[model samples]
Target: MLASPRPIPSQRLSRLWYLGRATGDLAAGLGFKGLIELAQSQAQDRPARIQISPEHARRFAERLSELRGAVMKLGQLMSMDGTDILTPEVAEVLAGLRERATPMPMSQLVEVLTREYGRDWDRRFKRFEFTPVAAASIGQVHRAETHDGHRLALKIQFPGVRASIDSDIANLGLIVRTLGLGPKGIDIRPFLDEARRQLHREADYEAEAKALERYRACLGDDPDLAVPQVHRDLTTPNILAMDLATGVPIDRLAGPEYRRAERDRAATLLMRLTLRELFEFGLVQTDPNFANYLYDRTSGRIVLLDFGAMVPIAPSLITCYRQLARAIIAGDRAGIQAAAIALGYVGAADPQDQVAAMLDLLELAAEPLRSPGVYDFGASDLFERVYRQGRALFHAGVFSAAPAPETMFLHRKFMGSFMLARRLRARVELAQLVPLCL
Candidate 1:
């Protein structure tokens, strides 16, 4: 058995640790900046390929993975949106968090299982594996079997993760502010506060179990989808137990061996699910890590996993988004801006030029929907164009407010699905899906 992790730092102590790490990063960044300036002065006409040392980024990621709560979740969020804003080295390193996170040692796993069940917990299972099958920012999952021949997946929360949420959130805010990862004018406090709230919800396994049951109820009849059945007897606030569903990670289908038509069908199914989550169910699983989806080839079903990040949609916001979708389909920029203002994306007092720029960016994002037929995500330049324009707008100090909590997660879920569609080179007729949802 491996040694357990050193206990995560508490509220007061973690703040100091985060500060120290931030200071180190600041020094490294300044050093890199100075080197760039010196190189520019020496080579007046030549362009330079600028990158930070890989070690700086690696160390940063390692520290957050070790902490494993709000800090790691924040890293996951940054990695999701970091391509345009972060240096290549930093972005590459943070991207690792999206993969299976570091798992707890066998010893720590024993302690948690013992705490949740009794020290004689082995009696409850016919067989239980000490090694984890998957791990993430909040927990690690292991395989188990009951005496009645039921196989199960047990998601065990890290011992201290829930306790450390508030501190990790505060520490992350300090680190981001000190490093200035976003535009200077943007106030990310609302985002940070929302992250804190969501973290609390995610850390609660009991709540996640209820969400799983709710989703099963709503989506159970769908022939192309699968949701695991929760094992309530084995479940607790710190541990979630569900029937083990066999499947390959959805990303595996992105390879050349899969037929283009099959890939397109998969993407379309996911898009339809997103529409249902928004307009029909009003509930969404916001974390977009591709690993959360699995392809059960035998059944041709998309297996949904991990409901910890599920969130309910606001009804009013859905109406606003419906209007925005209609405006995008009609190519009405003014209508788009009006809907955006309704959704709190802009203000009445903003200058017309600034609002127009924002509307243009929104329209660009809607490129896939504007097409009357299939949208070729693989060949599209919309993502790149949007990044370039959004960055330019940010540099111009056009954006001030952080997105509302509902909008932020909704955007994450939708954008994440789009990125996956592109990865699979999946073509979809998104315009048709939009109306069905409305």
Candidate 2:
């Protein structure tokens, strides 16, 4: 993820204060009995129990949402990036925090616009739609039309979002600790911190404008893809202005109108882009949220959006994964094991235990590359079987803790994209594409 801009010392302290306030509530409720019950419930066949009440969960979600700074950012990460760590109830509750952000008032909106486009900015736009077309945690987007006849999408960050970031992060750490998410279990802190950094980078419209141009140039001459043009003169640190591209969400391939071959081709293009992004480009869009992709049915191309979360992969790590892929295809289990260990995936104690897990995980990903015809992602029991095996490991103390935060994000992005392809019933020549990297 792109590095976040540094904050002032006062801002950092404020963030810690907010974190303390949130955790203070949890500490008061979490008595020794609560802790014991949490342990007993966790020891059972299911996941760790939430000894806390539904009412408290709602309250917790609300505070995080209202804070809507780093705290909400971390909560949203758990919703998407750490879904496995949470039970269904907790996941559902936490996911709401992603969408529960209170909107910034129109007055705040005008203030932001004035700062970006100047006092005469209203005159440049023939019409400004104050009502947002969509809302996410960090900001809301509005459809606007300029006198120059360009329909643009304006992304306006919520008031104080930048200012509150540090405090929110500090508060998030305190809450996670108070709730007992540490190295012994799944350490979600890295994921949370990384997400916050991206969100902060995203808050900078100027950076996104630059990243958008870089992506467009990077993917130049590709007929099957599209990236929107940025209006640099009008862009600002918080307000991103770009041409409003028209296309349906990529998942539209789920429709019956999509031919199997077309579905497969679409999936192929996406997977190929992913491979190139990592192996060749050394740059990746770390956030693979479904909303980022759009389908142009008439042209048979995919429209890519949101460059703020674009990240650079280290050449060494990319080489490591590329080697691992070559080993997997060559059926070198020992090589794969060694790669896994080098990647901090396996500890010396019961090392094979983790290798077995990696094998099972890779099998799910590699199945399509080995098999022909439209892959039936719907029919696969990978999720259930993996869940069962994972639960067993947790019980036996054979399974180690979570993968590195970076790996976890990469897995989510891959799984998310793979699921999209599977939804399309895409028949990609994944195996054929692997050798291209080597």
Candidate 3:
């Protein structure tokens, strides 16, 4: 069902413009580099010059959180990948910003509802919770039961989010570049362009509905998981209605009460899903926010939410990934490097020194996947090794930042889930799922 077009309001537009400008100003000031310098200065107090990164990163994150929107979305991404780049405190700030969406007041919500249900939306729902059940970058989700007695989750897009996307990305790119996070001196124009395209697609709920149906068909058979079903009729570009799969967040792995064995099972299911999404189905919901996965312990199912960032991979891309996976399983070092070079990850122009760094990273990444006993997330040394090599590569201008915009968001999602699994001390057999892809 097509949603009636909802026009943008003047007031919302002005608010977005104001937010965008504030973010741009901050980007120009304490950008990524500024954050690093601030952190570095704090490091001087220590004998080993150990960075007090978490504290400084938190300060910067506080600013990004206040700005919200696409910038907040970016902060969430940074927070998820904290193992490599950010200290825990800095990551906390980013993580704090993750689910912290600015609420769309009842007035704005009504304007959105009026467009979708023909001004009689309040009448359609027996009751609508004014307080949002979940809040994300461009939307806030509410809980409601329809007059027909169906329980549904309602996701309403924040007012004027679509219009400000371009400005948001442009401003965000400026901040990240000034922070020197990407390939130094590389033209990141392509990545920014891809981000804008994806964000616009995310603003559309119709596409998400279609994608959700397809995923249901794909993973509906997984006894250990649940993908929320889309309510097509109730759905608008802005409003996404679905049956809510209630559960404790996977992040509860961090709590003391969760059993060790239970945590391992949760981690296994998550790993299996990623392998299935990338290799078997060639379709994936790429965003890796910890908020996206929920643990319904009673049912032993992982609830997957959000499909706007989904990507369908080409056969060759899947082939490249599988080849890389195969190389790891076989423990073929030369084969791994060949595949990395073919995948355009290890550049031909990179001297032997840089090539060694790439090899070290590849070897570290393949470790837990290849080990016979268990992959230890708690003891994982890969993050530090990669972080060190990543910094060196950036300084050497050896690596050109590559966003398989397809795999880009997927990586974030996978990494975050894995971190959660690690915190739980989950011992999962990597080969079990990888073999399915094979």
Candidate 4:
């Protein structure tokens, strides 16, 4: 069910005001809760630990969702970055941003259509649904049918999202710095810059349409994968029109209705596609949000959506990752170290202890690849182990040397695939898949 349509706070002042209010509300809520918990703890002679309750998280998420742009995108990114660096409570709060966003009011939606199609937008479509089929940080997607009887999905960019990208990021940066929301000692500027750049590209429907067409062509009639076709005539700078590809949400396959083999095959296809994106096609859709993928039960094909975050992979980077993978598989520490240096995971000037720690972390991450066969994602403790190691590294300031922005983006996709596999409890022959990529 959709939340009631509320006007998006687009202006800098408006957005800033909302942020300030949300922050105040959160602080007050936490303060009051902490006092109550502290009283109880003192009475019981136990130490008090203040935590962000579910109520507080819901309130924070509601404000961010209403804003629906960089603020919400930042929250989504934090959630995807996982719990290694964040308190579990904070992670839970940001996780809500990944769900549906509050849609623009019908009037606001019509205003955009009028501006784009010039008042007679209704003439072009046989039928247009006012309610969005999907909504996200940058835009909402509506279901519509063309006069020629072609069903289409129209992605409408929010008003002022493109114009406010820089200011939005700048303001969010200020808030993050003031609140110390970032990991201590680590410079998040590179990540912020990369996000700003990606948001700009995402806001441009024209660029997204081109990316969608190119990515679809790259897939080239693969039986197990599907990409929507762009409807060029219906596309605009802010509105993207494409063939409506339908399926159950990709995560739904984790349910009892899906057989173990079906889940395994689906996850395998995603893992293989990730490799192909880097090593073969030289293009990667960096957004790892599960919403971007869908599974057609009847066709048994994965439907890919949202090409806005698609990035071109440099051949050199591809070679570097290939080396990294082979090195991991071969259990060659020296090879892994070399590849890590090449990939900027660690610097030569860094302390030897930090470097060695990073290597340990990398080796742990590659455990699935080292497994003999059919590593069970559902039963694995890799994420927990990784979190513990990562937290240690973070406290030791190992992440202060941020990787190249491109590497960060690619890492997100890789982690996203891993998380999806875990969610489906799919067993994958990662050892076999590594060879094909190599």
Q: Best candidate per TM-score, number?
A: 4
Error of 3 at 122 (Å): 1.9
Q: What TM-score goes with each of the models?
A: 0.88, 0.76, 0.85, 0.90
Clashes of 1: 0
Please provide, for model 2 over 1-438, each residue's C-alpha lDDT reduced to its tens digit, 9 standing for 90 to 100: 111122222265654665566565554545576677667655654444444554555556655555555566555555552334444565566656544455566777788788877898889789898777655556777899988899999878777777766556655666557766654556666777776676688777788889889888889978999888898777888888898877776656767887877777878888888888788877787665555787888888888888887777777788778877877788777777767666666654555655687666555456665565545554564555555555656656554655566666566567666766655666666777767866
TM-score of 1: 0.88
**Cα deviation of 412, candidate 2, in Å:** 3.0
Taking the tens digit of each residue's C-alpha lDDT, what string does model 1 give over 1-438?
222344545565864576467447635753767567545733442223335556776666666676677667766776664544457677767777765566777678889989999989999999999877777789988999999999999999988889888877776677678756545776788887887888899999999999999988988688899899999999999999999988877767877878888889999999999989888887899988777889988888989998998998888888888899988888887789889889877787888888888888888888888788999887887776776688677766678755576578888899988887886788999989888887
Cα-based lDDT for every prediction: 0.79, 0.68, 0.70, 0.85
lDDT of 4 at 143: 97
Give the number of the best model, judged by lDDT.
4
For candidate 3, the TM-score is: 0.85
Report RMSD for candidate 4: 4.2
Can you write out model 3's per-residue Cα lDDT over 1-438, one digit (the tens) per residue?
A: 111223332244454455455454544545566666656743432111223355455555554544445666777776665644444555555676566555656777888889878866788789888887766777878899988988999988887778778877776676567756555566778778878888888888888888888988988677888888888888988898999779876767667887877788888878888888888777888777777888887777889888888888888877877888888888877777777776777876668777777767777766667787677776676655555655655556566545355555556656665666665667788866678768
Question: Would you list the rank order by TM-score, best first?
Answer: 4, 1, 3, 2
Q: Please give the TM-score that candidate 2 achieves against the real structure.
A: 0.76
